[model samples]
Target: MALPEGKMDVNLSNTAVVLTDPQNDFLREDGVAWKLVEESVKENNTIENLEKLLKAAKAQKMKCFISPHYYYPYDHDWKFAAPLEEMMHSGGMYDRKGPLTMEEFRESGADFLNVLKPYIEDGETVIASPHKIYGPENNDLILQLRKHGIQRVILAGMSANLCLESHMREFLEQGFEVAVVTDATAAAKLPDMDAYAAAMINFRMIANAMWTTEEAIEKIASS
Candidate 1:
């Protein structure tokens, strides 16, 4: 059976790539959560595919935005969080010194993945405020998109079931056309629980469209 797939005719002028949590803690081999998501990450060729998208966007001069995850000291003191947030807090997943200080953020696990750094730090990508939790509700991402006159969002990046999914949901609610790149993202392979499997189902149902890395690159090239 085939799912009713929604497709976006990529327009160079208004299309942007919104990448969530493309940080070391999720993409690097020695990252804090590396052990948990390694299988899916490798299987998806996530790192290379993410690079491909970034390179393509750069080449086309299409705008790209980064919605990162970070945890400051005060955040850990919070009294409540979802189960996954609890794990993130406990494991110090995206620990950073503070918002204004780059002392601990630079080259930290919370930093952008090494391969992605050149693209993110090229002074063109719009790096929004760190999302305190799983979604963009607490950040300036929507505003950033609106500011850039971005309407079609090519969404990609780490951990399929968590931040990526959450971002997709919120972007839809905010009236943006979103297309997720499946091969550019991955999820945890927990025992008897395939996070990637669950995320793919939701992505299909909620996103305006879904594409693989190759497909996204092609659309970007033609846009």
Candidate 2:
């Protein structure tokens, strides 16, 4: 059966740049996922590409939202976890090491990259309440976007197969039009699987559109 037709043109007035897990724990060299994702991130020039996308979005006055991953001390109390979730907790991937309202989490290795900080710290870019792990269910992202009257999302950010993909799935199901910036996200490479490769296949299959940063920037500018 043919899928129902949908519009691809993004209406800037109702569009927001929604990024997932743009933290140092995923982008920086010292991050836990670095060794596994270094090649893919470098190959795609993820950081520079994302910077360009962010700058363009700001210039175009497009609202931006960040769906961050944070694990507070209490999260360790969860009784059961999936393999990856268990690994994340064990490795302290995004652990905050402090209370939820404390600023200590911002000082940790899980903070957003320095280059992206200026854009994010500004009053315009809204940082949604941190997602407990990966998806929007545990976060206030959808609420934040809806409050801003957003209906479309220009999506990007870390761990293509994990957080980024999780964000994409939820956003799509929530009746939001989503465009995935393909090069703006990267993924870990495990011993038995190439996560980035896996993500690309799904990205193309599921997202309304899979865009390069340049393509997305151009579209946003034209809009």
Candidate 3:
């Protein structure tokens, strides 16, 4: 689909692609939690489509920022723990026995590091963000983007009905032009696909624009 004609066209010279939680903990077919959310990810074709967009963005020399989700044990977020335990029970979650460590994540079975290896190797900035929280208190995603002078953000990644929606709302509230890549995000469970779709539809109303990867790329290329 094409971008809306009346909106301010993306200025690729100053645009950044904000990839949120495109991690093995979420996106990969062989990922730890894949089974629980397979339907959402599968139906959206998120991994395949996102890989295509990521490669194109990199090739076009656009600034790329990847946000991965992490959590600390005993963080007092029990509401998050219940669903997580359900996921674990259903074979959709995994946990390392020790403290969270990037080194451990790199060495672990998570496929995100391998999937995004090219971007990392090519010096793309990877910003680790907190899981399941919104706004500045959660993490410094928006601040980091602003620091880089990013005025427009093309958002993609996991849990479309939750984290993606929260991030989009925060971006809009902060006055950034936010464009959600429709085919690049999914829900945490199969049953949430409808919820994901509903959220996307709602986002389309309030966001600067909602575009497919091709439309976003063309818009960028034109700029």
Which one is best on lDDT?
1
**What lDDT is reached at residue 20 by model 2?**
88
Candidate 3 at 69: error in angstroms?
A: 0.7
Q: Which residue segments of model 1 deviate by more than 4 Å?
A: none
Two-way TM-score contest, 1 vs 2, winner: 1
Q: If both were scored by lDDT, which would come out higher, candidate 1 or candidate 3?
A: 1
Q: All candidates: CA RMSD in angstroms?
A: 1.0, 2.2, 3.9
lDDT of 2 by residue, 40-59 (tens): 89989999988999999999
Location of the lowest summed lDDT over 10 successive residues in candidate 1: 99-108
Better of 1 and 2 by lDDT: 1
TM-score of 2: 0.93
lDDT of 1 at 187: 92
Clashes (backbone N, CA, C under 3 Å), per candidate, total 0, 0, 0
